[model samples]
Structure formats: C-alpha cells, structure tokens
Target: MTTVGLLYPGHAAEDDFPRIEVMIDSDIRLPLFHTVTDGDSRGVEALRAAGEPERLAAGVEELRMAGAEALIWATTGGSFVRGWDGAHDQVAALARTAGLPASSTSFAFAHAVRELGATRVAVAATYTEDVAPLFAEFLEAADLEVITTESAGIATADEAAACDAERVKELVVAADHPDAQVVLIPDNALRTAAYIPELEERLGKPVLTANQVAVWEGLRLADRRVWAPTLGTLFATREPPPGIDEHRGIEVRE
Candidate 1:
C-alpha cells in the first residue's frame, strides 16, 4: 500500500480522506494527523501560525511511523494566507520535519489545475472575506488566472463544516463563472468528496475541492496514479509528468 501522510489542521472534514479511500479502493492509504490551529480563529495570523513548524512537527513522527511515503499540509487557507513564497517554505519545512516529500493544499490546487490543463478557475471559499482573497493571490502567483472568487465569510472551520450538502451546493453554484474552466473550493474543513461528481454535473465543469486535491496531491507525491471514476474529473485524469515545477509553481513537461 502507498501511504501518504496528511498533516491536517483541526477536526473538520478529515473524514473525507477515508471516504476517498473507500471510493477509490486503491492501495493508497491516507492517514491523517490533526495539528491544532490557534483556537477557533480562521484569520491570517492564526492560519500562519497553524502551518508553522512547531504545530506541524508534533504529527510527523506518528505519520512516519505509519509508513507514510510522503506528507501533505492539507489546508488551503493556512498555506495561502502565508502567500506563495511562505507556502513553499511551509512545505519545505514539513518535508524536513517529516523526512519525506511534502506539499500543501494550496500548491496542490495549483498543481491540480495545471495537471488538468486548466488556466482559469473560480474560487468558492468558505473563509471570511479578509482571508479568502489571499487564496486568489496564491493562485495568481502560480500563474493561474482567477476568473472570479466567491467567499462565504464563514468564521471558523467548525462553522464551515456545519454547512449541509444543500448549502455546499449553493455556495459552489454561486461561485461558478462562465469564463471559468473549473470551480475550486479551497476550504478543507467542508465535506466535499461526496459532492464532487454532483457539483461537476451541476456546474457542467470540473470541480476541485481542498480535500479532493489534497488526496490527489498526496498520490502525486507518492508517484501513484489512481483512477477513481466517482471522485470527479480530477480523479478521472492522470497527473502530468514530470509534474508541477515545485520551484516555479508551474507545469513541467519534457
């Protein structure tokens, strides 16, 4: 089994990983280790601290012991709030701390976007206004065009998690843009794996969510390509090789 360690923050939506495992039924194992965020705040300062080495370090040994071949810092808000360079630094530190190749949901989205050959996307974020725009900046840094962004202004991960399936559908539908090639939901806290297929169908486009892309990123790091038909378009496709330019945040090809 290929094991990808997930250094996730807080309690919300970690279950999505297991659901993905069951849906894919592949040998890829996603063992999530929750790191603590600063209290309940989803603000920039709190998110920056949440991805810091000290918080992430606590879970490394456990995941390493679980035979994780790679690690992912699985929160879009945490990494994006730190901006592109800072997000790269965050994953670099995680790679060192865990003694494995590392990445985050922010970079995961960037790589996932390029892997699908998409250049423009719309964001459906569950973060507060003050926090959500940074995600757009993060994507822009990766050379992607942000067609539109819809922020839910949800206060905390818990509140975001409380959004029922209908509300999740509404948020995604509201975020869709005619010019967008794909719709991205950058909140890992929301339960999104189950709704990927439906969301894609409703929007008539690719739907990329935090948890979905995180798993896909982990699989990429482990060098395993999985075909999960029910997991939506991202899963239905293959990772572009040699993969994203880790240094430049763009797609790399021979």
Candidate 2:
C-alpha cells in the first residue's frame, strides 16, 4: 500500500482518483489539507500563497506523520509562479520538512512531456491570458517548445474549478497546432483525465492534464511507472531512471 499524499488547496476534484486508481492497484489515501484559497482558483497569489511555505511545510509534515511515502503538490499554477528555480527550491524544502520524496504538478508535466520524447507542445489554459507566458517560460526552462497557447481568460478559483468539461475540450481542440506533437491542459481546476483517451485518439497525439501528470510524477517519485492506455503517453511510455530515489526529493528529471 503506497501512500501518495496530494497537497491541494481544499477538497479535490471528485474525478481525480479514478485515473490514479487505474495506475496503482492498492489502497490509496488522499488527505486533503486546508489552504486559504478555493479548490478551483488560479492566480499568482493563489498559486504562491494559498498555502504559504510555512503552511505548506506544516502540511508536508502532517502527511509524513500520517505515513505518506511521497508528496505531490497538486496545483500547477501554484508551484509554477515561483519560476523554475523557485519551484525546485520549494520541492526541496518540502521534502526536507517532510523527510520524504516530494514533487509538484508543474514539474510533473515537464517530466511527463520529456519522458514521452515530446519536443513541441501546444498548451490550453483556463487562466487569465497573463499566465500563459509564465507557463511557457517554465516549460521552456525544461527544454520543451511551447508551440502554441490558448487561455480562457477565466478569473477566480471557483469559476476555474467550475469550468464545464465540454468547453474545456473545445478549447483544447481550438488550441491544437499542426506542428505540436503533444497538447497540455495544465490546470487541475479543469477535469482532464476522464477525457484524455478520447482526446488523444481524436488528435492523434498525447494529451496531458494537470492532475494526471501530478499523480504520475508522485508515483515515479516512489520508483513506480504505470502503463494505462487512458493516461496517454505519460503513462504509456515513461521510463524511470536508475537511482531516481536519490534525487526524488529534490531534483526532477528532464
């Protein structure tokens, strides 16, 4: 029974666990921690301070005390605001505070994109358009090309969380680029896992969502890899590196 701790702002998306369950066949516990923001929100402040470092550290400690083998920060915008170096530092600090492996949704996406050997990617975001560049910068730092981006200009966590899945699919389809080999829907606030297989089949490419990559990265931190057709390329083809355990708590693979 591998305990993967998901640190999010509030209650998680109801549909998140089914995808994770499809990967790891064991008793999985999701201990939701309270943060100052709503579950489906997005903003620089929401990402960076919903759970401040002190609070985040405390949350990590709580999960460690509860016997979580690995920790995953389940918000993409949250960890990404700190930029690449800041994101790396946050994961390192959390790992040190919790005494276990740590990873985040942003890092997870980067790893998943690279693991699939995808060099060009199209991104569809349900955030203010301002966030696209930040996301692009983060992905660029990881050496993945951001071929195109589309944002819904949504404001507030509640609205972002309440986004209609059908609309999300439409946005993804609209943002698809001919040159892009992969499409990334980088927001946990939107329900993406449930539609990945169908979307991939239609696009003839990989489609990765925030929650899917976050869970995948958490499992990888535990030295696990899963091949679920529903997860698209990240799960279908990612290979874990040797001795990854030594760096799981700090550095992320690129």
Candidate 3:
C-alpha cells in the first residue's frame, strides 16, 4: 500500500485525516505525525508564530524514519508565514531532510485552484480577520482573484479543529458568491471532504478544502494521479501533469 506522511502541528484540527482517507483510494495509507508549535489559542497569531523550517524538518525526519513515502506539511498559515519564497524553501528543506516527496497545504490550494481553471474565488476561513489576508495573498500569487471572503475570527488550532460541521456549512453558505466559480476553505483541520458534494450542489461551483487539496497535491508529487467522483471538481478536472522533475529541489517521490 502507498503511504503518505502528514506533518502537522500538535493539537491540529482533526478533520483533515478523515477527509484524506475518504478522498484517497483504500490502497493508500495515511500516517500522520504532529510537531508541536507554540500557543494554544488564537488561530491567526498562533499560525503566524508557528515553528520554522528547521524545526519542521526535524519532525518530518521522524515520519520518514517511520516509512512515510511522501510528506505533506499540513498547516497552510504556518507554511505561508514566510511568504512564497520562504514557503518554497521550507518545503524543499523538508524534502531534503526526509529524502522523500514533500508539499504543503498552501501550495496544494494554489495548485488545486489553478487545476480547476478557477479565476474568481470566494474564501471562507475560520481564522481571525488579521490572518485572512495572508491566505488571500497566497492565492493571488497563484493568480486567482479573491472576489469575496468571510472570516470566523476563531482563535487557536484547537478551536479550528473543534469547529462543528454545521457551523462550517453555515460559513460556506453565507460566504458563497454569485460570481465565484470556486469557493475555497483553506483550513486543513476542517473536515470538509464529506461536504464537498453538498457544497457543490448548493453553490453550483466547485468547493476545494485545504485537506482535500493538500492530500491530492502530495499524491501528485508522488506521481500518483488519482481521481474520485466524491473528491469534487478539483479531482474531476484534468490539467497537464505536474512536472516532478521541476520540483526536484522541493521533494522527491520514489
């Protein structure tokens, strides 16, 4: 069975793992490892203040020793704190440390949106208003337009993880835009896979969640092009395959 390693912070949102399992084929095994980051409450500040690449790389090595064939840094805000270049370097360093394929939730969202050919997007975040723009900047760098956004102002990774599915659904529903071809929820801890079909049905647009896209991106890095109807439009759409060779400095999938 193929194994994917998820490098997340301690007390991260729990919804991500289940979503990954549901999205990937049963043949894939997802083994997760948690790296503790400072702070216990406040989403924006905590993510902004999370650990650096060196610390993250050390944690990734543990997963590698455990036989994780590919690695994904599962925190969107933490990876993007250093901006695109820094984020790129962090992923590269982790790949080097683990000697395996690597990617992150931030890159996953960008790539997934691009793959879907989505130009205008609406963002629904569980972060504080202060950190929402960071997510916007990351998306804009990938060339997607942020047409609208809704922030729940929830503090802390634990709180984001503990958010109820109904509240998440309400946030998505409230944040939906008529001009948005895609609605993006970029929190990895939110259990979004189970609601993709429902969200798509209601909005008549593709809904891409952080965990779903991150898992897909990690699999793609491993040269595993997988598709499933329940995974929503990101998986349903086709784009030129990702150039693994180009990502050599970033990660390697054997």
- Residue 207, model 3: lDDT of 92
Best by TM-score: 1
* Candidate 2: segments with Cα more than 4 A from true spot: 12-15, 22-31, 38-41, 238-254
Computed on alpha carbons, the lDDT of every model, listed in order, comes to 0.87, 0.75, 0.76
For model 1, the run of ten residues with the poorest summed lDDT: 245-254
What's the TM-score of every candidate structure?
Answer: 0.94, 0.88, 0.88
Q: Please name the candidate that would achieve the greatest lDDT relative to the true structure.
A: 1
Candidate 1 residue-wise lDDT, 22-44, digit = tens:
99996878999999877878988
Q: For candidate 3, lDDT tens digit of each residue in 186-250?
A: 78767677768778888888898887877777777766767676888777755544541223226
Q: List the residue pairs that clash in candidate 3.
A: 42-155, 42-156, 43-155, 43-156
Cα-lDDT of candidate 1 = 0.87
Q: 1-254 in candidate 2: lDDT tens per residue?
A: 66677787665463566656754455655554544564445667667776467767657656777777788888888888889999888888777777778888898888877677667999988778887679888999988899998988886656766777678778889889999989998887766677788888888888999988888777778776666766666777655444332224463322
